[model samples]
Target: MRLIYCCGVVLLLTLFSRVSHGGNILVFPVEGSHWVNMDVLLRALHSKGHNITIVRNSKSWYVEENSTYYHSITVPVERSLGKEVITHLISTVIDFERGALPVTSFFNMAVGMMGTFTEAHRIVSEFASAMFDDQEFLRKLKDSNFDLVLTDPCWGHGIILAKYLNLPLVYNVRWLIAGEAHFSLAPSPLSYIPITGTGNTDKMTFLQRVKNVVMYLIGQTQHHVVVTQTYQKLCEKYLGPNSDFNELSLSADLWLMRVDFVFEYPRPTMPNFVYIGGFQCTPAKALPQQLEDFVQSSGEHGVILMSMGSFVSALPADMTNEIAAAFAKLPQKVIWRHKGDRPANLGNNTLLVDWMPQNDLLGHPKMKLFVAHGGTNGVQEALYHGIPVVGIPLFIDQYDNLMRLKERGGAQILQINSVDKDNFLKAVEEVLNDPLYRMNMQRLSRLHRDQPMKPLDNALFWMEFVMRHKGAAHLRTESYRMPWYSYYSVDVGLFLFGVFLLVLTTVFILMRCLYRTMCKPKVKQE
Candidate 1:
């Protein structure tokens, strides 16, 4: 017994001696669902003995003043987003559905981003200026001497902060980002990948490709005009005279994109681009007693969950009435995630609440199908649980996600405006009754789970990989350094075309001269 105890102690000592503490990592998460992204990563890093400080601009589930895992700094930011911007953006989707927004759904998103850019810029600037101007706060924040900076490029301010701290930067792309913010760190061609808001699939026709190209061109033409001015001014003010944000975005050490071929189609990615999709996910959790009772009370009929995400809480009265009517027709129990007033004449089979354990609810054996507004998180969760989806996508990437899910045969999309009881009933029936949907969902779930390492583990591996290699500059592709026209080979194509046209014109001119000389009136001249 004495010898065994000594051996155990020696083993523990050896393990402790082998553990190497990683560098300090600073995380800046955007407000809303994006905050939920860190549930796994931050805690895992903490358990591994790394210093993690989260910069909190608003209230969220992930952060507290003090925790065993991490520390959060409270920064008051007054600007409120989501409600008005999304309402307006979705109102345009009605246009696209009706063929009024033209062919380029990618360009239309740029227009929406244009309308909201000023507000986004203002909020980011205020947050940045607040951090910079506070003498004591700034001193304390800088005193930590962080080694790496991790940011969600929901806005373009993280790169600036990385510059301020003179630390290695790693950016997190929180969504598919097919069009909106992908151009800087990665390249997504139109051959396979669709635009973010456009309901296009990988198999696009020639005309669809043409529309996609036009959208890309329109996005390129207006991209710099809409976003860069504010970024440049803020860079000058906060980061010195010549510190441009554009240059910083391209030069970031790594880009962790929340995308994968399991959910998204295959696309070209650079060495610095790491796919960490579904990292925010977990293996489900135990349901609270109330939720457990609710599912149990449903008996063998099972239940369905309705969630429109955190940002979209309100539904038009007419839309609400339609969804309620559809629930009334179904035998399965209904659980809706809503905070506002409930629709009148809601069926006894239906229950409404502001919140429920969504992941747990999805993982329930009684969960036959999920009715969601098609947020990436919600859609991905439904996919993870291998539950067929009845998608009522509201705005932005939701539409694109819904389209992809439909193409994958695991979902049926119900249009918000055209969602009568019949259509909603049809979607629910199709998802629940069709065995094919379940089979497809199961396939995708397997693919998602079959990776060499867990998504969170893969994320941590790359995060530390960049830190270990001292910024991983060699992973950044030469394409980032190429000028826009040169990167697209537009200048080269145009130069070659111009030479061909010059030669053709010269030959035509000479032929005309020679023909005239041959047909000349020589006898008259003599």
Candidate 2:
């Protein structure tokens, strides 16, 4: 017994020593603190004994319960290479259309850069801008002995930074990104190809499935061209002025995604992708005192949480009024996250604040249903709390995510354009009253939480894995080399050929039997 105890202590000490010296990880958030995933991921890393530093804005405050050694510096928004000139030009065009550059423009640009001159231009421009930060985040990245660089897809700069530093990059995606070649990165089956094992797109409705196919087809050429061009430009900046775009595209290495499986269930996957979502150690602080008091007043009625997210609040005044009116009539109390202080004729049943503690509110026992714009973070929070939701998706992935939640039976969905008091009230009522909705949400919550290891630990482990392997080159190279047709082999020619062969065989067999019967002497007598 003494010998066994001594051996166990020795083993633990060895393991602890290895972990204490784990590789350094540098994280770059695509967006500011408003992004919930950023906070969650950082918290997860800190908990798992990983050394980390953030290259982000000073104003971007993310809560961490236990502080770890980190460097925080604001990257100046202004930089030259005059990339902003082109960015602003594109922004102007989009602003004209929707009063903003719009996230779709970024998606479009990402797809277009796959194979275009603009792709090269954007790559150089982004690199220049990223490295030009006044705080010298790039310089620190170079000086620091970082094992891996983790970043959001929106922060393409991280790719260049990793390349320049000869480090491995782990990409994080907050939402489902549809692949032109195969299935969408989202949890929904809408991206599946029927015959090809790439995905099972059959899980969606006929109309939605058709829509997915069409979208994929239309975006294919654009994505390829854009990515190819951007890679070329990136290569020229790093490799040489004479480097070919095609070769650069081939050399580009980006880890697909590093999210947790719980948030994206039932989605098909390949080995290169990693999901370490819900990395935030735990939910943030509870709701404020004033907010708590308002909810408690509702008693058995409970409260409904509503938010349109941080980036876009394009809900027209008329629509806002309609929503207010609907909430005014509900038996439940309403706590809305609206940036503006605009007063409405809503009854005492409503509470509007510039911002609300979303996760904390979801954790509340009195909280009943969540009304959201269906962003990934919000969806994760709602799922974590096992609260049924009514998703009024406005733009981008919101529509698709809302549909996913509805399909999962944990929420009701409503289109933004068609929303009114009646529809809004009805949707809220359905989520609140329907026991199945709560049960379904609870089921999803269990699945989300039932992972073998916490998302944070997995994220840190993988970050270190990539570091130990000295850049996950094998995964990236393999993922890139896979051709679209080969990846999703829904070959019409093969199907046709198989059918033809089957028909010919059947005909030949039947003729042999018929000829024998007709030639027989007994058949003639009959």
Worst ten in a row by lDDT for model 2: 175-184
lDDT of 2 by residue, 299-382 (tens): 999999898776543355667788888888889999888755354657678887877778888889988999987876788788
Q: Give the Cα lDDT of each candidate.
A: 0.75, 0.62
How many residue pairs clash per model? 0, 22
lDDT of 1 by residue, 1-526 (tens): 9999999999988667545455688887665667667546778877666778988765333456677778877776665344565456555565564443343444556565565556656667677777777777678768988879888876666767888888888877753112444654567787766766557788999877876676666555554653565566778888888776667767778888776778887776678878877777777788888878888999988999998886767576667887899899888999998766788758999989888889888888889899888887888888888888988876667878877778988888876656888888887987888799989988888888888888778888888887787688888877766777998899999999999999999999999999888878875687
Instruction: Give each model a TM-score.
Output: 0.85, 0.72
Q: Looking at candidate 1, what is the lDDT of residue 354?
A: 81
Residue 52 accuracy (lDDT) in model 2: 72
Off by over 4 Å in 2: 1-22, 32-35, 47-49, 56-69, 73-124, 127-140, 174-208, 228-231, 241-267, 281-285, 472-479, 482-526
Ten residues in sequence with the least summed lDDT for candidate 1:
175-184
**After superposition on all CA atoms, how large is the RMSD of candidate 1?**
4.4
